[model samples]
Target: MTDLNQTALQKGADRALEKIEIDTLVVGAGQAGVAMSEHLTKLGVPHLVLERNRIAEAWRTGRWDSLVANGPAWHDRFPGLEFEGLDPDAFASKEQVAAYFEAYAKQFNAPIRTGVEVKKVVRNAEGPGFTIETSEGVIQANRVVAATGPFQRPVIPPIAPKDDSITQIHSAQYFNPQQLPEGAVLVVGAGSSGVQIADELQRAGKNVYLSVGAHDRPPRAYRNRDFCWWLGVLGLWDAEAAQPGKEHVTIAVSGARGGHTVDFRGLAHQGVTLVGLTKAFNDGVVTFQADLAENIARGDENYLSLLDAADAYIARNGLDLPEEPEARATYPNPDCVTNPILELDLAKAGITSIIWATGYSVDYSWLKVNAFDERGKPKHQRGVSGEPGVYFLGLPWLSRRGSTFIWGVWHDAKHIADHIATQRKYLAYRDASQRSAKD
Candidate 1:
């Protein structure tokens, strides 16, 4: 490992700006970046990982202090390390997770430059590679990996708009319950965050209202099957294309919709009131329609039935035999928390404090690169962008249900690293051939 002093780092960055060569340049040092960096190093690929802030800054800085991950630590553990010594089923604090990531970077000696922001990426016309314009300096590399995850930007719903009288804040900005106004609160979007926030506010003795629309509900116990078990037995999220063809139906099905559904039944047991989808909030009053809950409940039923059918098919095919798969815990159905919701007859109820948990939006506007589809998201085939030498990781449905998970990044990283290696080999072969022709 090189002793990266400030002056030395600056000089190297400056030289890199002058068309210096590199095997790979990775952006973002979060889970994806760190995992990819370690894998690339193991493969003996010369590379550098760039981060806009300190390592795992988002986890360390953005998330609230007391907030714990909804998913258990087992499922969220990063590759090459297991979360132990604490409660196994316990959710990790943001600090704990951040420390783990930093330790991982140190273990692998990942070359990460903090406080360096990559502003733009320009592909070379002659086909050798691309140049990344960064705040530190220009960097030239044969390949670039955009490891920025899905939560790049917060998505605020248009219905809430932005007004002076009522306060608006994304779940990202929310810290303590004191941030909300001293009145009845309305939290929109019924995924994990919305439900959790509503629960938190209710516990704090604040009169709270939750507006939930279409959401997939899971039970806290399995009646006969666990979806995670089914996923593993069916090899639903295994190595395969993320397209919608015959070999990839499972990946398409579990795409990122939003936060996970919470134990709503538990919330109801706690006496928190829920509402339907919020249609409008104006003139110091919130307006909602009646049919929102009916529609949401219908969607929930259909999704559960689909899972049940898949489980049955798996059993019929002798898929869940003891010797055929690794023994694991069964998936639990979400506790239905819908009963506690107040009907969205907003005209009759008074509400305050709007928390927009509607969802997150993908923002690539700053990149200034032409690599997205009609949906304003970067388009990639197995992490390979349509343009040469540009790649992406941590996309919602990039490869499978596990694509965004910490464990899932390992497989995706290996595949992408292999692809980059192949490209490097081809370039070497082509250069050799061109020289022979000239000679």
Candidate 2:
């Protein structure tokens, strides 16, 4: 029996060496991968998308049951599919998003290989091709588009230095409020996830301490001067810092850096005390760096400044004013007010649970390809990388609205698929030339 098991393992390892032939191989099947496949199929391109798990795994396994998209329903749909439901404003649940992704794959007949975990992706030194090693099999393609997404890994500060008594968990592992420790809880990271988690814990009757970071605050309503409109108008969604122009800006100024878009006002009303940025956690007490209100205000100002810069760029470039496609009425100086902030120590507040809502990290160490920028972010232009035939999708700010939301991925996918088609032709020509030379 032991020999049989060993034989099977060896066979699987050998199969990993057999490089299957393909035109293009995408390493992911989440929103970005599905969108890429849809675009490629629409353009009649031959490609394969590799997913280690079922489609839309994040929506299936990561999110909480009570969670709904922060953005409107219209903003949730991907390419070739419209969000279906009675309420257009109603946010879709995680299950709904997953179902839609599954349907998208079936509807378009996207060539996807599920349960195929990509082990490594490396550029072929001999030619303008690349090799991808996966658990199911190996594949060599003329082009590779990594749609693995930014949230490839859960990130916890290496040294949180928190007391052993304080239970700590990343937001990825958190399911619901019931899982929280008894007594008060301190939710760190004020991004969308952090604020949302804090809101839930407080509503569940648990005393909650929210560590507020610098973050953008947008109105919940759709048909108004919301953040998305400003995103469109300012071209923040499409502007790239790598682009050689004054329109480009670093991510720090963008305020779109981390995914923190929860309704702070609602959370505050629920009695979730917003504290300043957490400096350290030890001896059952959380130390803060500055005033919570000051940090939040600074974050809001950064977001507003980015918007202003974007608006200026539009005027300078002679771009037409953005039309609010679904906006019903403008909320000029709306009644919505800023969520007031408070600074309090966790130990004094008697907080028990500690949830880190501090966003995610992307690790491309497995890729082993020379395609990243100084910050390890993939160097790509609308999904096409500097390395010929290499591409990336679902990257933040790849194009207008392409990075932050699912609805925006199509813009980058369409362009990337078009680029893939050209590469396919190039590969075909090259192969023919090689055969003729041999003959």
Give stretches of model 2 more than 4 Å off: 1-19, 125-128, 222-266, 299-348, 430-439
Question: What clash count does candidate 1 reach?
Answer: 11
RMSD of 1: 6.4
- lDDT tens string, model 1, 14-105? 24443445778889999899988888877767787889898888788776546665445665677577664656555677787788888888
Q: Give lDDT per model, in order.
A: 0.66, 0.67
| Cα misplacement distance, residue 44 of candidate 2 (Å) | 2.5
TM-score of 2: 0.78
Clashes of each: 11, 4
The segments of candidate 1 whose C-alpha lies over 4 angstroms from its true place after superposition are: 1-20, 220-230, 234-261, 299-350, 434-439
